[model samples]
Target chain A: MNVLVYGAGQLAQMMYLAGAPLNLNVLAVDVANKTVVHPVEKTVLPQSLEQAINDADVLTVEFEHVPEELLLVAEESGKLSPNLQSILVGADRVREKHLLESLNIANCEHEIITDIAQLDGICERLGEKIIFKSSRDGYDGYGQWRSSTAADLPELKNIFTKLDLHKVPIVAEKMCPFTRELSLLGARNESGEIVVYPLAQNTHHEGQLHTSIAPAPLLSEALQAQALDIFTRLAEKLEYVGVLAVELFEHDGVLLVNELAPRVHNSGHWSMHGADTCQFENHLRAVCALPLGSTEHGPAAAMINIIGCNTFSKNFLSISGVHFHWYGKTVREKRKMGHINVTANSYADLADKFGNLSEYLPMEFFPKLLADADRIK
Target chain B: MNVLVYGAGQLAQMMYLAGAPLNLNVLAVDVANKTVVHPVEKTVLPQSLEQAINDADVLTVEFEHVPEELLLVAEESGKLSPNLQSILVGADRVREKHLLESLNIANCEHEIITDIAQLDGICERLGEKIIFKSSRDGYDGYGQWRSSTAADLPELKNIFTKLDLHKVPIVAEKMCPFTRELSLLGARNESGEIVVYPLAQNTHHEGQLHTSIAPAPLLSEALQAQALDIFTRLAEKLEYVGVLAVELFEHDGVLLVNELAPRVHNSGHWSMHGADTCQFENHLRAVCALPLGSTEHGPAAAMINIIGCNTFSKNFLSISGVHFHWYGKTVREKRKMGHINVTANSYADLADKFGNLSEYLPMEFFPKLLADADRIK
Candidate 1:
């Protein structure tokens, strides 16, 4: 079967590798140029984007923010998935908040603001401290504003007005002191059979994901169940097919929705070596209407992100049990370079081995010296 | 590091896949035409074989029968592994039998018959029941003769004389009735570190391996230990580097060496999904002077060979936990098409799943009807 994925990026490249043995023909379209190319074939140009979509048995997106018009074309032919409405929810905070509220899901109390005057009302309703976020194109802590006190709110509101907040409505949320961040990656087939991978504990630095540990050691059974419950409710509500990642913040003992990704996600990259089926392969299987793979963990896993620089001179290749995935991307400042998955017999052992990662990893990139030590330990 | 392998068959393809993530650049050299190519890059050109060899950090073979001149070049450069002597022992029965005898290892009783007169002397010494084998280029039950009666012996001797057996030399053996077949896949590094995976119970049809079960289910502890002993001794004797596979036969409870593969063997294919580090990866690691990967099995795994003519149908996509690997070979008659690995919680469960393989797999291509049933129970 042929599959056309919108966006030619690392995720699409990995999907191509996983699909090869199954005899699944895959062409990735870089919407900007409307050029279709194979990830590994690297040089083989296929039909035009429109022609490729016409030949595909299924069409999907690597990222949610694909242009609406292109998505409409795919949807018109009944091929696009998670569908346009679902993609919009993930792209726009206003729609995302509405969906969560409609489902009665717990999220930080918030209000949509379109103008400086609306921001003042939102601050009054939320609290003295509020986080302002653009409803669209905001990611990695970008397109945001913060008001710590009532006196500061008016100035922040003025700044929002100058930026034309009304043109792109913002979601103002009450800032909460959450203890930890967790994420649930679950998949559902068209048949509605759903499977949830274990919750993952995520850590980030400089607004980019730093690492994630699977089965999120020390997570209570109640917390895991609650995360899965939230995923099941959202997946069923959207009639979702393929993998969905729901980011959560644990405030006190309650989990609040932070964000939702309607496609395979970064937090689940550990599954490539740790789980019975990787999220990419499972997503492909689910989208192809095949039985979902077993999501059981084979070993305790820890994933550390490789960001921007590649100068860790300790020789990553020297370590046993380390699987490095280089995305073959041209490195730029703060760009995601690749990741390393370390699997061990036990969570404690994995932590212990990773503690010595500095011996092989270049430490200059990870500025949080103590944080690295604490994480692996 | 770059490695130039001397064959472009399945073994070379698997080695290429295993070496890729390690950033090891592996180029396959077509021995027939002396052309060089990369499996993933899939580019072939008329470069001098010597140039490809000069480009590699190390030189190796997927199979042992590379032309002696190529082996000599690699040997002169101190890059060839298992060396020409060790590889020649595996390729020629005369040298293999002589080496075993010199080491005081018990093997099938045989005589080196050069003519019809020598055959009669062989029968007089080892009795009427015997097998005749060519000293070189024999595999998959090819290039050998079998005689059960005296009348057949005269014609076999005549055939040997016609082929000028004296110049090539041939080994005649007293055929032994063996209860079962097994193999040991082990690796030895340049630093003298050795790691052996569990012995595998193998079943063959028409001399081609059909399936393998790890830990050789139901075997006594003594036999397993003896198998390891044989492997250790053989590895040390040749100072072998990289993975070596030793095929064995069990007569009653005693194990006897059948054949040896100096590279990753078909019997170890299960390691891809079953073991922590597959044989192919470990072989690459050893050859590159890198740390070895774990060989721990996730669960009892049963690997079924998908030979030619047994094509995958549309419904084949429905089998969960079944990992399929298809080699893009165009030839259809009796080829090693691909393989399907089915991992289960237990041996019985795996056997039960293997039984249902026919529903998704075409069965006529397999010579033995009970192959699916007897794989792993």
Candidate 2:
């Protein structure tokens, strides 16, 4: 079977790797250049995007931000998995919030603001502290504004005016004093068979993911149940037929939906080394309508993102349980070059290895990781 | 860094997959066509073989049977790892036998026969039971002839005469009465650091590898020590700087060297899912002169070759611990298409999963696997 991915990025590269072992041909479309590259075969034959899509048995996306025109074309072909509506919901915060509210999912209290006048009394009405995010085209802390206190309102208003909130509304959310960030990754096939991975505790640096620990050490059964319940409800409600990641916030032992990513996620990268079947492979399986693989976790595992650096010594492999995954991309500031996934017999052992691994990583990209590792014991 | 592989077969394809996460560009040379294909980027741009070799930081072989002319070119560039002489020794049975004798390695008693006349008294002098092997270009039971009794000498001599034994001498070996087959895989870097994987118990069918169980189920410390000692001696002797596989025969509790493969071997495929570092990745590391990763084995693992079949349902993945590796080759009778690697907490669990996995594979290609799985308990 052939699969056409919408975005030609690192995620597509990984999906290509995973598909090779299943006798599936995974081709990625360069959305901008309109070219197709077979990530495993490493070949860019002379084929148009329309021809490639027509040849593919199914169409999927590596990320949610694919151009709407391209998605509409794929939707017309009736081969796109997770559907166009789900992709739009993931792409636009306004649509996503509306869907969450309709489903009665407990999310952060928020209001949509299209004009500066709507922000006049928003601080008083909601709270002094709130985060404003662009309704569309934002990621990794970009296109976001925050009000630390009432005194910062003028600066927030200035930022809102600069962002041209009239063209794209902003989602003004009440900042919740949550305990920690967590994410749950799950897949549902066309047959409605769903499999959810263990909840992963995540840590972010400058709004970009830095570390993820699977099965979330010291997790309560109630939390696990709640995460799965949320995943099942959302997956059924959307009739999703591929991997979906739901980022959440933990407050007073209750989980609240933070956001949704409609694709294989970085936080789930630990599954490559720590689970029986990885998220990438499971995503392909769901898209192809194959039986889902097991989602059982290894004893313990952790993933550390290799951001903005690709010059580490291979000596890091000398550490017992450390596995490096370098995305073949040119290095640049703030770029996610790759990641490392480590598995161990116990959470303590994983933490110990993570600590040892941190010594080899660039301090600039891994400070949050080092702190997290030190707290493992 | 870039690596140029000698062959564009599945081994090279796998090496490409392993190298991608290391930020290394792995390109394979189609020996016959002299065309280069990048495995990960899947692009076949117009580049001469010399230019590809010049661009590569290191040169390695996917299979030891690479054309000698190509090896000479890579050798002249001073980029070939494990060196050209070692590859010749692996390719020619005569050279292999001489090396084993010089190193005092235990091997089957054998005599080199240049002509049919030299084979006249070979059977009588050695034993009624003997096996004849071509000194070059032979694998998977091809170029092999066996005599079970003295009466079969005339037919063997007739077949030998037809084979034109003058150009390439045949090594007449006495068939050792052995208990089982085993193999050891090890990697050596230019820095002289060597790490060996645990000896694996192997089973062959029709002279092709069928299944491998890592840590050899019920291994003795003495057997492991003996295997590692042999590997260390051979690696040091060859000044080897890449992965090597030593196929051995166990007879009366002692190990006898059967043959050696200068590249990754089928018996080591289990490491893909069962070892901390797979043989392919370690081979790339050694070739690139990087620190070798750990060779620690998972608790228990098994690998079953998927010969001449790609029709199995993906439902096989529904079985816990099963990981499929399809080679993306067109189906052909008796051809090695791909394999399945499974890992579990214990040998018994591995065995149980193996039994469950067999139900999904074709009986024609996996009869021996079914029988072996039945005996796992």
Candidate 3:
């Protein structure tokens, strides 16, 4: 079975690794160049984009931001999974928020702002603090402005006025002061079978995921059920055919939907070592229409990202259950060089591994390593 | 780092899959054509074997039977792990027997037959029941004959007389009555550190491996210690720097060496899903001079070989903890198509899974599947 993924990046590379054992030939398209390539080596294969698509048993995306033109070509082939509508919803925050509201899903109070003037009564209606984000991708996407206090509103409004919000709408959401950020990752097959991993508590540094603890320590039964219910509703509605990640915020024992990622998300990467079936394998299983693997409960696992640093010794692998994954990409500021997955029997054990791991890494880059380790208890 | 593996077979393909996550680029040398190729796809790469060897940081072999000329080229690179002597010993049963005798290791009582005349009193010295195997691999190799009683000695001698026994000597050993067959797989690093996985009980049918159960049920501490001691002695004596497997026959409470596989062996395939650190990864880590991964014991695992068959339904994967591994190879009579790994918390649980898996498999092809499952308890 040949699975062609739209993005030639880490997730696709990981899927390639996972798929090999199952006899699934996973190829990646460098959407930037529109050329089919080997997922891990990134070497150009002797096949045009169209030919690769024609050869693929299933078509999927590693990221939702794949160009609309290319997605159309894939969608027209009738092989793409999760379909175009689901991917677009993940790409456009406005559409995402609308879907959440229509489903009666609990999410932050928000509104689509096409003009800067709409900021007027926003504070009185929603809250004093609000974050504005571009609804689509590219430099225009993930673009953000925050009105944390009354004094900051003038500068935020001035920054927003330069953009034509009509062309690319912005979603203004009242920032919830949540206790912790968590995410539930699950896969839905063509047969409508769904398997969700335990929620993973996330910690971000400078807006990038820094650490994730799976089956997040101190998980309440209610929170677990709520997360699964939310995923079930959204996936069934979209007819999602691969792994979907729903980012959540926990505030006062209540869960709120924060974002949705249509494809494999970074927060689920820990499943590579944490779960019986990693998300990458489950995603391929779901997309390729194979029997879904079990996501059975296992030991506590922590995934710590190796961002923008590559000079450390890998001697830390001597520690039991530590897996080092380097992407083999060039070093650049804030680039995800690789990640280290540490599996332990208990939260305290995971914390100890982190403390041991912190000693080997360049401490400055992993500023939150020790902190997150201590938080596990 | 690039690892150039000799012999583009399933073993090399597995190594490629295991090496990718560690940022190791693994390529295979098609010794049959003296060309470099992708291990899994078997596609000819755009590089000469010489160039591949030049570019490789480490060189290893998937099968010890690789042509001596190719082994010479690989050994000349000064990067081969397990070294030339270790590989040679594995290829020649005569050398293997000598090494075993030199170390005072208990193996089958054997006699080296260089000429038919040597068999005159062989039956009297060893036993009436004897099995002879070619000392090397080739058309004229693995040539075997068995003499069960006094009446069969004349025919066996007549068959032996037709061979150029001097050029290709044969090892004639008295077949021993054994209760069980087990193998210990372990890795020795360049640092001389050794780690061994729990022994896997193996069952063979028609001279091909049919099934294996890891940490063989009802294992005694003494048996485990004996196997470990055997591995450590051989590895340290050879100064081995890769995974080595020792096949053993257990009689009463004693283990006698049966054979040595210089590279990863079929019995160890269970480690892929059963052990915390699989044998392939540990082999790559050893040859690459990386820290050896932990081989801490875990759940019992069973590996059932799919042989000469490709018509089974994969729905058996619906059973929890069942991992199906297909090698993507064209099936041939008696060829290993792939393997299925089933992990469970105990022997009884493993037996139950085997019962479920047997339903999805072609029972005719797996003659011992149900019987072995019953034996597990």
Candidate 4:
């Protein structure tokens, strides 16, 4: 079977690798050029995008933010998985909020500001701490703002007023004070069979995912059950047919939906070694209508992103269960170069591996390395 | 780093997949045409063999049967691991026998026959039960024959008389029989760091490998250590810098050397799911001079070759720890199309999985599966 993914990035490259052993020929469309390409090499393939789509048994996206025009064309093919609305929901915060509301899913209390004037008394309505985010991605001057007090509202408004709110609205969310971020990666096949990998606790640095510890250490069964229930409701409601990532915030033993990614997620990358079936394989399986593999994980696993700095050598791989994955990308400031997946006998062992991992990585880049390692125990 | 492998087949394809994650660009030399090609697609690359050799940081072979002419050129590049001798030893039974003899290795008593006339009373010298094998591959009428008594010698001679024994020669050996076949896969890196996966018990049907149970259930420590010792000796003698496989015949709690492969071997395929590092990745790591990975295996594992059978579906993948790998070849009688790697909690669990696996595999093709499954425990 042929699977055509809409973005030629690391995710697609991973999907290609995962699909190969299963005899699934995965091709990618470089959304930037709208041309079919080999995901790994990022080299243009000898086929038009239309030809690729027509040849593909299933069409999917590596990223939810695929160009609306391209997505429309793909959706019209009647082969796109997760469907258009689900993808739009992932791409647009407003749409995502509506999805949560429609499903009665637990999420951060928020309000959508379609117009600039709606910002008036927004802090009072929401909370003292409000996080204002651009409802949709890929727009000029789109960014986020945080409001702590009423005094900072003017400066936040000054930054927000420059944007065309009518074109790309603002989602004002009352910042929920949570313990930590966790993401559940699950897949819904065409047959409506659902399988979810263990939830992974994510640690972010500068708004980018730095690391993920799977099975989210110390997580209560209730929290896990809650996440699963929410995922089932969302997937069934959307009739989702592919891997869906639900970012959640756990507060006082309650789980709240923070965001959604309608594709294989970075947090779940540990599954490549940790779980019996990886997210990429499950995603391809779901989209291709193959049997969903078991989401069972063996040992405690963690994924650490190799961001920006390329100073590390292959020496750290000397550690057992340390699998290095380089995306083969050129080094740039804050660019996601690659990642490392580590499997350990226990959480304490993982913590030790994490501490040992710090010795190899540039300390300036991985600021949380040793601290997080020490914290894991 | 680029690793050029000779012989564009499933082995090379697997090597490509394993190398990709470590940022190793693996390409294959289709020895028949002497052209560089993508291992997975078998598509001719834009580069010539010379360019591939020049560009590769290391050169290796997926199959020892790579044409000597190509091996010579790869050797000239001063990058081929295991070197020319090791690969030649694997390609020719005579050279392998010589290697074992020189190393004082234990093997079946054998005689080299350069002339068909030398076969006189061969059954008396070796035994009534003797096996005659062509010393080299890739020649007309190169095959194995057995003789049970003096009565069968005349017919065996009749068959051997047609060949030019002066060039290829024949190896007549006492057919040692006792217990099952097992193979040890190990790697020696540039720094002389060696690691060996646990011995894998092999089952053969009609001279073709049918199944491999890893950690070779209930193996004695002494036997395992003996295999590891012999492997260490052979690898050190050759100063081997890649994965080396030693096929053994276990008799009376002793392991006698049967054959050697200079590259990855089929028996080690179970490592794809069972061990901390797969043979392909370890082969790449060895050749790339990277640190060797742990040989730790997680559970009882088995690898079943999908020989000439394309009757199975993806449904069997629903079995947890069942990993399917298709070579994407058109099935032909007695040809290897792909393989399945299964990991189980125990030998009993493995047996149950094997029985379950037979339901999906064509019974006629996998005739030994159920029987072997029953015998595992």
Best by DockQ: 4
Candidates in descending DockQ order: 4, 3, 2, 1
Model 4, residue B268: distance off in Å is: 1.0
Model 1 C-alpha lDDT per residue in residues B155-183, reported as the tens digit of each score: 78656666766667677888888988889
Candidate 2, pairs of clashing residues: A41-B42, A42-B41, A42-B42, A42-B43, A43-B42, A43-B43
lDDT of 2 at A333: 83
Q: What is the TM-score of each candidate against the true structure?
A: 0.89, 0.95, 0.98, 0.99
Cα distance off (Å), candidate 1, residue B144: 2.0
Off by over 4 Å in 1: A30-34, A37-55, A67-82, A138-142, A312-320, A330-333, A366-377, B37-54, B68-86, B102-106, B138-142, B219-221, B312-320, B365-377
Give me the displacement of residue B324 in model 1, in angstroms: 1.9
Alpha carbon lDDT of each predicted model = 0.77, 0.87, 0.90, 0.90
The residue pairs found clashing in candidate 4 are none
Candidate 3: tens digits of C-alpha lDDT, residues B1-377: 99999989889999998999899999999888999999988999989988899999999999898898888888888999979999999999999999999999899999999988888888799889999988887855348778897678888877777888888899999999999999999999999989999888999998999998989888898999999999999999999999999999999989999999999988999888888789999999999999999887566898999999998777887888898888888989898999998888898999999899988989888999999988976
Quote the TM-score that chain A achieves in each candidate. Answer: 0.94, 0.96, 0.98, 0.98
- Per-structure clash totals for the candidates: 0, 6, 0, 0
- Pick out the ten consecutive residues of candidate 2 chain B with the lowest summed lDDT: B37-46
- For B244-300, candidate 2 gives per-residue lDDT tens digits of 999999998899999999999899999988887899999998999778988877788
CAPRI classification of candidate 3:
high
